[model samples]
Target chain A: MSKELIRLRDLVMEFDGERILDSINLYINDHEFLTLLGPSGCGKTTTLRLIGGFLKATSGEVLFDGQEIGDVPPYKRQVNTVFQRYALFPHLDVFDNIAFGLRVAKVPKAEINERVHEMLGIVGLRGYENRRIDALSGGQQQRVAIARALVNRPKVLLLDEPLGALDLRLRKDMQNELKRIQQALGITFVYVTHDQEEALSMSDTVVVMDKGRIQQIGKPEDIYNEPKNAFVADFIGESNILDGVMLEDYKVRFFGRTFQCVDKGFERNEPVDVVIRPEDIDIVPASEGHLVGTVTAITFKGLNYDIIVEFRGFKWLIQSTDHCAVGSTIGIRLNPEDIHIMHKSEYSGMFGDYSSYSAEYDELTEDAGDEEE
Target chain B: MKKNNAILLSTPYILWMLAFTLIPLGVVAYYAVTDPVTGAFTLDNLAQLRLYMPVLGRSVGYSIVSAIICLLLGYPVAYYIAHRGKVAQKMLYMLVMLPMCMSFLLRTLAWKGLLDDTGIINNFLGLLGLPTLRMVRTPGAVIMGMVYNYLPYMILPLYSTIVKIDRRLIEAAEDLGCTPVQVFQKVTLPLSMPGIFTGITMVFVPAVSTFYISQKLGSADTSLIGDVIERFFKGNNMNLGAALSLVLMVLVFVCTGIMNRFGDDEEGGVVV
Candidate 1:
């Protein structure tokens, strides 16, 4: 009767004394599309392996349907994994390959044939029953791998960057295809990828990780618009982080000026990083302004112009519909609703004691915290 | 490859085949169908083919039996070596080759001594109060020599084949719910067919043409084709010898063709 499908409790994984995954705790809800997003070697694949029962956890327990499966081999588990290489059996034709698991389970021959055809139809490989695996194109082969995994009707599916070997265009198209499949089946899906755009577009919950730790877990919009720490804000999308202090409950200071921001959860005078998305900062005419600055450069970004402005030894990359040429003075205004104030813990690591990381950022936020004084 | 350049690239190998294999067979052919005194065609030698065909048949039958034994014994040894660690593999490979360092005559002599009527095995049988076994100068001795001479030939190729197969293919089968036995049946055996084919051809073809192993171990009554060919050549019957030689060459070609046609393409794996 429980809705939770998988629970990973404080999992720790180490291989030969090298810690790959450190104390990971999470739960996967039924029918949710979740993504484990991180850079390479951040233990995303290790986590998936632990859940699939391929690798045993050092300390934690993985419960599927309220049953502990720490000692079970991968085949006995109800979860199935699609490897990056597609791992198709080359000797078996398309139909035999899909029927492999069913036959192994001692299913009746007639039923095995029926399920195999049904699976092939589901994966859009209806007519490729007799094709050799090596003879099929890369895209068609991927479909067989999917059908092979789904034929047994696993309760959850884990894909370890299955599209990593695909070309960019094919990978993008498969991303949408995977989403469609998950929606149709209503099965819990755990996808792992380092591509930020792919994670944001397809995942219901994006769990961002770094350096063997979970940084944040939230909806895609919250992770993008309101990052909790400097790491999350920077990793999710580009943000112009500025050093600032909370002047009052409703106001913050940056760029030698005070601006009213909607984020208000700190004592007075706490150090913060102000995040304003490129689209949030408007490029107004020079006469009307919250702050006036000179445009250092302009870049054409297909639909709009990215205007780089300098003021008070700070620079901001603002995107706007009203075009501004390089070397022109411009007025800039930060929309309070779009202002994301982050704590200083995240940016300290980036700056290496806050200098080398942001010499570029220093020019962008030269007047930080002056509005309060 | 383009047609012109493909032929150009193959010229050296083609010429080499022509000189060594085709040229000798051509001479044998010419002599098999000719009268030495008149350079005229005669069935005199061809008419004697019926007399030697039975010996040819026995040789083929004997070789197939010995090769089967070689395969059955060699397969497990090759599989163990291929799956062994790097150091173990090298050591086992060297052990297999050590017997080859001595001349084939020496190895066959040792086998003859062991299987003689009053030899070590018969003496042991007498001591055990069992009937003194008959082993030497019989069909068994010829088979023993065939298997011993070519055991390494069978092992080496089969080991290399099994070692090169993609282990992931086997793992994929097991992961797809195959019991270990089913995995071997569906994946390992099919993948290692090429290695079995290699070992069989390497052993059987040479064993059929073998004269020394048979003569040393078998009785005079065993009329194998190898002994017949040996007698015709050594006894000054050149016409009969040339005819038998041509027959053996054709058999080799036919066997090689079968191997090329049905050898395991997935032999990129270890001999399981």
Candidate 2:
């Protein structure tokens, strides 16, 4: 098992009596890529800042290697951060920017030059040393920020949405590049982002948070396949969440029909939120379907069509490659493993409905979310 | 059409500059190169500048001292005000500027009142059985007057630039292993160079050429180039006054040019 590098115990952060992080307890294993995934104002970035020693928790302790470092200043910590905006020094060229940390530590001049050049090669900006910050493009500046932080060789690197400003293609490339760098360096990386896909693709462990509380923590597959609540189910991916009652172990009642599911251990006859992922539902013939619905809208995504179907006046988004005409009657099938049952939470009924869904509206909300953080 | 409209809108300012600034400058240049009595072009006025070199040197010395003192005093005040909360920053900035709303001569005269041999301070000291200090009509008094008059210029630009610096840059520096002092030395100080240059120029130019402050605060031994220029003009020696003014303008130009070079070097090269 990997050793723990950093642990936060009962950490609570408050600003003006309003809590931003509520009793957060987590341990980061050495060489693990852990992502704090949530929407804006979800305390993910606040937690990252606490780890970086930029902010002290209002109460509780931040333990680095089993030692309380609550009073340690950011400059004294062995952790660095890549800020959301990159925050490269505008007055310094690329070489000087990457060499800043070494210069501050009074490292030997020849060693500083060697390490900075190695970092430049790692970030793939080999000959852009003399280029000023504003002269570089957004992506190049982002690489400089990463290189600048990584050149310190800190045990833990905190990244707060480092790819948030990049274009789609560059963001994708950098996502993979970050994972490769983390594996090669064998250091802990605590990344924070609101992009669920990025967290799922790049992290070994995903921490889902909301409203200043961690909702769940698990591997990416487990967090996606067996969410702990409606919030996690809805936030991780598109889900059709319906209010349901547990009939017995391995059985649940929804849409006035009892369905077999893989989940158990709930109190018999307990009211629960049932989650069915969009891609998990199979389009079948009406005769063979467990339930029937009417298609209301169809959006042609690149790989599949996002079909919104209305069943008993409730809309559900379904991803299917089959082309079903608008206003046509359709059927969907869910297997025992496809059904996920979560305990009733405060977030129940707040999401999982696509009645008012539109692609443009989703994009608008995502843009607004970016600005809020 | 848009370009024409822009030029048309600037006509009043263009006309004002032509009538006031350009014409006055041309007249000064003309008088500096001409003999007053003969109305003939000659360098006699420029040749006489050597006679007042000591006065010019003293003026340069006093202004440089005042500028340095202002920088040392105003930088901390500017930095403090910039880091304050929004409401407090606004109030402090207004306080810095409040003295400037009054007339410059009145303010210098008020200092004269305070620093006179039997002025309020000395009278108060005498009442307490303390020795009366000599303050007015000294080099210190002149330098103090210049600093007091021009300190707001130093603080205003410094506050603006320091306030505009992104707080993230400071945080980035600290995260990169810099102590608080190093953060200031490596980041905040370099970024504020433009403001420093601007503040020095704003304070030094007026302090160097001011005649009224020296007149109110200095003895004959501390007479500056401005005093000599004023006396020449008052005595109807227009050619000599214009020549001194021309030399003063050149000195200010060279100083600002050197400051701009330092500022540009700090700005770094833009890789087009």
Candidate 3:
């Protein structure tokens, strides 16, 4: 097994008597690009701050390579952080900003110059050593911030939405750059972001969090396809959740139809929530498909169209290249293997009971199949 | 369209400025150079320049010393106010600026009463069975009065500038392995320079021209250029007063220029 670079065991953090990070237990392997994905106020940034030693945990221990660092000050921790605002020193030029920590350590001037130049090259900013941070573009400033943090050569680098300030195009560019840098340096990267797409595109492990609790932790594909809970399914991306009963070990029904889901945890006739990703669904020929629905609306989305199909009384948002006009009668098929089922929570609010949903869907599917004939 | 509208709107302000400001300055300039005996351009009044030169130098010296005194005393107070929590910071600043609402002359008179040989301070000291030291009618009292009168000017600007400085910069400095002292030296001091420069200008210019504070707080020997100008204008020698005013105005310009040069293009700091 790969040795864990950083481990947070039962780490609980609080602010003003309210818990911010509730009993967080996460272990990051060496050189893993682990992303903590959450919406704003989900305590992801607080998690990063805890790892960076900027804030103290209320209870629990943070271990770096097996040593407890409960009371370590920020400078003493073997970690560095890149803040969202790119908190670069305004008085220093690009080179000096990168060399700040080294100079503080009283490293020789010749060595400082060498390291600064090396960092400049690493961030693809070789000739920008003399440039003022303000003079550079947002993308350039972000690169400088990264280089500054990385130059310290910490065991783990915590980036608190470091690309949040950059525009969409630049954010995408930096996402790829960060991934490449993580691989090249072989250092643990704990990135925090509200953008699920950014986390999915770049991270080796994505930890979905909600309100100081972990929803799921898995690889990108698994988190997208095999989300373990209702919150994880809903938070990571768009999903059509239809509440139904788990009729048997492998069968589940929603929106007046039984969908063959491949999950095993359920008693017979127990209520279960069914999750179907929009992309996993398609408008198919009515004779050969699993479930059917009529097109309520169809809108263009660059390469493909967002097709909103009505099933039973509920609606299923289907993404496809098929062009279906609004109010068109269209038969739909939800791929069986794509379905996910989970235990219900009172806090999980979306679809109601599924018996009525199935009845409504069957009526719409029958109408669409007749239209196709 | 925007440019035309801006220029048109600025016309009234420009006219008011030129009428009240530029014309009076022109009148002062004419009087400063006009020959008193010949009624033509001559050095007749200029011959009396040496008589006022020492007083002018004294004014410069007093303003510099008092401004430095205010700066040293006000910096820590302003920094303390800027760093306190929201409620405490506001309350402290309110107390610091409370003196501004009171009449300046009343406050000066109160200081006079407090500093007198038989005043409350001396009485209190005597009650403590301690020697009542002489304080009033001295240069020290004058400097004290000047500092008290203009302290708010030196503090509020410094407080505003210090408050805007990002606390994260200091935290970042500490994170880079700098001690608390190094953090202040590397981050806090440089970031607060703009406020310091502004505070200096605010205190220095007023202290140099303030004659009333010196007259009330010090002996006749401590008279400043403002006192001389007041005497000349009162004696109906407006020309001499105008000449002194012109000299004071030039000194203000020279001092401000020196200060601006020192603080120009301050990093992470507002210059104006």
Candidate 4:
């Protein structure tokens, strides 16, 4: 196992008296691919900049190799960045651009030349040493940028949405290529992006953030399979979050039915949020299911069918390979292992009960009628 | 034939150019080749350039020196203005363009008052018990006048181009083991070459052909090619004047061509 290479303790960042990052604590292991995953304005990019030394935190300590690095300049730090737009020098050709850092350090001429050529070959651009930056395609320019940063052999590489500008096919190709390179070099990689699938496929540890705070940090499987809060469940994948009550140990009550569960230690009739993965719900005949519902919509997703069913006025989204006809009654079954429970937060008494919503809607319409009369 | 509306719309400008630009150039060419009084072609007018060779040399030298001085003084100011806040940028623009809005001759005359023997500058120096200095009517004074009048030409274009450079590129360079000074040298300086070329051309072309500034600020010993050309034409020596004018145009073309080659030619011209 790799040891801890970097630690962020009690970090806080503010811009114009408004907080951007609030009291974040994290530890990154050496040779591990750690990803900061969040939506826009969620402080993922701000956290990356703080680590890269481009922006200073309001209060905190950034410890590297068991020592605090207090506002040291970027040039003196042991990290490099691949910017979002692939900020290559337009004035220099590929060779000279890749050789810029080495020349600044006054490296020997022969070594600079050899290392640049090696980088070119590694990036699969052996004959593109003299091409101008604007002449290359987006993917090719991205490779050159990677080569320029990696030629210096920095201790950590910070990539800030480096694949954001590429199309879907090229993005997947580069994602696999980046993982291959990171393993071969065995350097710490701190990647930042809002693409959930990209983070899930590439990261060893995913830190999910929302609104300037970290909600959860775990392995990809743990985050997807067992989220701690409703936000993490909704952000990572398509989740059917419902309002339920824990009747007692190993049992929960929802939709007026009590089902067996593996969770314990909740107060009797404690209100909780239930997370059921779409793929975990199995569709069966009416007599074999615990609850019966009608299919409202069915969409072909090429790999699987995304079907929505309505049971007790609550819509359930299910992903399955079996085909189901719309406007047909169906029964859905859930196993005890598929039901995960968590304490209600931010979204309590607000979901899985359609009777209250219809009641409110009826009240509003009646008020409008009274006003007209 | 096709009835094109664009050709009809451009007819006025075509007539304007033919009447004002091409015809006058043709007349100058005719005068440079033939004697003005006798309708006979001769090379004597072109050969008379030997008489004014020193003035031609001095004109080229002063324009080059003044262009270099404008660059050295204007670059830092342009850089500072480009990096300023929004309110400060607008205020700096007003300050830079305020002098340009006044009449050019009026500004040169104002400089004359400031540089005279008993001018305000000398009076202030006398209060400090310093001896008076002579600055009027010398080559140095002529170059100074040129720089003072044309400094904005260098600053404006440089500002427009430098402001468009992506700030992310500088940050990326700094993240990749580059100090702040190295970031300027490696990224900022090379990217702003288009503005530098335009600024040099803007200052050099007018400085080489100016006679008013030299007459208003310099002594008799600092007679430039413009002074000789003006004298020949105003005194009815049109043939020699036309030849010298053609030579001056050629010299300006060659100097601008060399400067353009030094700029990064891929970048298009900055509008300002």
Candidate 5:
């Protein structure tokens, strides 16, 4: 394992007597692409700011290479940030903006030119040196922002939703481009983004946060397939969560049926939450399937059909390539290893409500309403 | 019918512009190029402006000095006010605008009264057993009047523009290895160019052409082109006064053009 280059110990941040980041500890290894992923208002940006030395911790230590850097100002720290709005200096052209840090350091003019050109090439904005910041499109401006930060060549690059302003196509393209750049440079990147797909696709380690606290920290697959609680499962992707009971060892009971799962170490008759990915559950014939339910809705998703089935007053979202008619009874089969069981979490009861599904159901019914015409 | 109604509704505004703006300018232009009595075109009135060269030079010098002083003083005050919280910002803005609500003539007269030998300030100095130096009718007093009366124009524009700057740029600069002073010099100063241009124009235009402040506060030795123009306009020399006014207008245009070039045009070029 790599050495820890940045460490946050029991970090707490408060604004106006209200907590923004609660007591928390995190470590980022050197040359690792770690991403802080969460929804809005989840304090991911605050955590990144603390690490970037832009914000002082209310009570805790921010250690860089085992040295406390809480009192260090942002300029003196070995970290740079690409702000959420790109924040490219409107007063300077693209070349000067990318060379800002080097110029402030009084770097030789010849060297600043070479490095700035190199950064422009890296961001694929070679001919945009003289372009005014406001004249460029949003994606082009974002590239300039990235080039400006990366030109500093700091030990850690903190990006705060850098691609949030781009459209879907550009966001996807930049996601791959960012991954390629990070890999080539091998710099420690602590990226903050609310887009789960962005985090899953690029991060070496994903730190899932919620309400000023970390919910889970693991690889993308672990976070997606083995979320420790309901919130993580819900936040990361679509999960069909069910209230269930663990019947000791690997046996779990849900929907009036006991099923075998890979999870163990639960006491007999223990209350638990069960999560199964929509794509994990396979669609079999009604007679051959383990569970039977009536299909309430179906929508074409190009790659797969997103079908919602109601079983025992609970809706299950399943992605299948086969065509299934609405209001027809269908059967779903779950593999033993696909059933993820965990102890009840704070968000377990808050989710899985029919009212929460009202919007999607309304859209589905609207299509049906249109079909009837 | 709707468009016609809209055009008819704007008729009063058109008439107002013609009466207050266009007619006065036409009259000035006519007087500037023609002899007041003979109604014959002449360049003699324009050439006669050279006789008041010393007064014109003094006007330019004093306006430059006042603009520089306002900039040096107003920039820091505006920077401080921009960083203040919302409530304090509103209260301080109200305080800055309070003096502007009073009449300019009255304010200049109040300064004249305060600077006189037997006025409140001199009396206070007398009670302190200090010498009451001569300042009532001097170029220094006139410059002081200019600075005091036009300082608001400088402060307001500077404050508004500085506060509108995206604060994240400063933070990003610092994050990229800029010290606090470097951040200010690189980010804050360059971004505040628009305000500087606006403030300089706002302060310099009135300071350059101010007649009452010079008349009320300065000696005859410190007479500016404004005083010369006022004298001609009052003493039956309308053509010459009109020519001098045109010269001042040209000077104002050249200075504004220079300021506009120096400012960051992408953000805000001219406040007006």
Candidate 6:
């Protein structure tokens, strides 16, 4: 197991009597890429700021290398941040920007030149040293911001949605580039983002958060395949969550039908939330299905069709390569391992319903999410 | 068509500048080069400027001192106001500008009244058994008057520019391991250069050419170029007065030019 680099113990942050982070306890491993993923207003960025020493927890201890560092200012901490807006100094050229921390430390001139040039090459902007910040495109500016933070040689780097400002194609490319840089440098990275796909694709460990609390923290695969609660299941990916009851070990009842599942350790007849991933469900003939439903809507996503099936009064979105036309009767097959079950929590019945799903509404909520923090 | 419409909309402003600005400048130039009585072109008015060089020097010297003082005083005030809460910022900015609503002459005269011997300040000092000091009709009093009258000009520009600086830039600097003082030196100070230059220009230009403050606050030994120019014009020596005005204008231009040269490398170069 890797050694712990930073730990937040009972960290609570309150602004004007309103709690922003409520007793967040987390430990980041050395050289690991841990991501805090959630929608905006989930205290993910606030948590990142507390670790960066930009914010002080109202009541808790922040430990670095097993030493309490809650009193350390941001400049004294051994970590740096790439701000949400990039925040490159407009007055400085690319070279000076990358050389800022070195210059502040009063590094020797020759070493400053050598290290700045090396960082420029690392960020793939070698010949563009003299370029003004405003002259660069958004992607190029993002590279400069990364280069600026990385040149400080911090023990841990905190990135708060650094790729949030980029377009889709550029964000993907930078996502891979950031992963490569992190692995090559072998430094711990604490990244925060609202983009689930970016978190899943780039993180070794993903922390799902909501309403100022950590909903789940696990490996990316574990987080995706076995969410701890409905909030995590809904936030991580598209899930068809249904209120279910555990009849016995490995047996769950939902849609008034008993289905075999891979989950256990629950009390007999305990109420649980059943999560079935959209892509995991396979469409079959009406007679071959465990339970049948009519297709209420069909959205053609490039690789697959998002078919919303209505069983009785509940709507479930199922992703499949094969298209089922609207008003057609279809059935979904769920393998035992494909079913994920969780104990009911505060977030039960709040998400995973596709009855009101619309692409425009999703985008509207995404835009609203961007304005939160 | 759009460009033509823009030009058409700007025609009135262009006409106003030509009438009140350019034409008046031309008239000044004409008066400065010609003999007053003969209406004949001559360099005699310009040649007479050598006699009053000390007065011109005093004006430049006093204005430079006042501008420097305003900068030292205004920068902190501007930074403080910029960091205030929204309502407090507006209230503080209003307080900075409130004195400007009164007439400039009245404000300077009020200072004269307070600084005079046996005046309000001296009377208060006498009640405390302190010796009366000679403050009125002195160079210090004149500089104080100029600084008092022009401080708001310096602060307004500085506050506007400082407030516009992105707070994230400072956080980014600190995140890059810059201490508080280093953050100001590296980020805040350099970013506020435009405002500094603008404030200097705003304060320096008016302070340099102000006749009322010096006349109201200074003795004969402290009379400035503006006082000289006013005397010449009132004494029916329009040619010499116009020549002095031309020289003062050139001096202000050269000073602002130097300030702009130092400031041009930064983005959003000096506002005025």
Instruction: Estimate, for each residue in B1-272, the C-alpha lDDT of model 5 and write its tens digit.
Output: 99999999999999999999889988998999998899899998998888888889999999999999999999999999999999999999999999999999999999999998788799889999998878888999999999999999999999999999998998988988888899899999988888998899889998999999999999899888899899999999999999999899889888888888877454545532
- DockQ score, prediction 1: 0.39
Model 6 chain B: ten consecutive residues of lowest lDDT:
B263-272
Task: Please give the lDDT score at residue B263 for candidate 3.
Answer: 67
In candidate 4, stretches whose alpha carbon ends up further than 4 angstroms from where it belongs are: A347-373, B1-6, B126-129, B266-272
Residue A304 error, candidate 3, Å = 2.3
Q: What are the per-residue Cα lDDT tens digits for candidate 6 across B94-152?
A: 99999999998799889989999968999999999999989988999999998999999
| Per-residue alpha-carbon lDDT of candidate 2 for residues A238-301, written as tens digits (9 for 90 to 100) | 8889999999999999999999998899998999999999899999877788999999999898
DockQ comparisons of all candidates to the true complex:
0.39, 0.91, 0.56, 0.74, 0.88, 0.87
lDDT of each: 0.80, 0.91, 0.81, 0.86, 0.89, 0.91
- Judge candidate 1 against the unseen true structure and give its global Cα lDDT, from 0 to 1: 0.80
lDDT of 5 by residue, A236-262 (tens): 777788999999898999989999899
Give per-residue CA lDDT, model 2, range B79-132, as digits (tens): 999999999999999999999999998999999999999898999999999999
Q: TM-scores, in order shown?
A: 0.84, 0.97, 0.90, 0.94, 0.95, 0.97
Candidate 3 TM-score over all chains jointly: 0.90
Candidate 2 recovers a fraction of native contacts equal to: 0.98
True contacts kept of each: 0.44, 0.98, 0.39, 0.78, 0.95, 0.88
Among all windows of 10 consecutive residues in model 1 chain B, the one with the lowest summed lDDT is B263-272
Q: Is model 6 an incorrect, acceptable, medium or high docking prediction?
A: high
lDDT of 6 by residue, A81-157 (tens): 99897999999999999999999989999999999999999889999999999999999999999999898899999
Cα distance off (Å), candidate 5, residue A225 = 1.1
Compared with the true structure, what per-residue lDDT tens digits does model 4 show for residues A1-373? 9899899999999989999999999999999999998777788888888888888999998988888875888888888888887899988999988898888878899999999899888788899999999999999999988988888888899998889888889999999999988998887999988887899999999999978899899999999988888878877777778888999999999888999988999999999898888899999998899999988878787999878788878888788999999999999899999998978877444433223333532342231111000
Highest-scoring model, lDDT: 2
| Model 5 spans with C-alpha error above 4 angstroms | A352-373, B1-11, B264-272
Error of 6 at A103 (Å): 1.1
True contacts kept of 1: 0.44
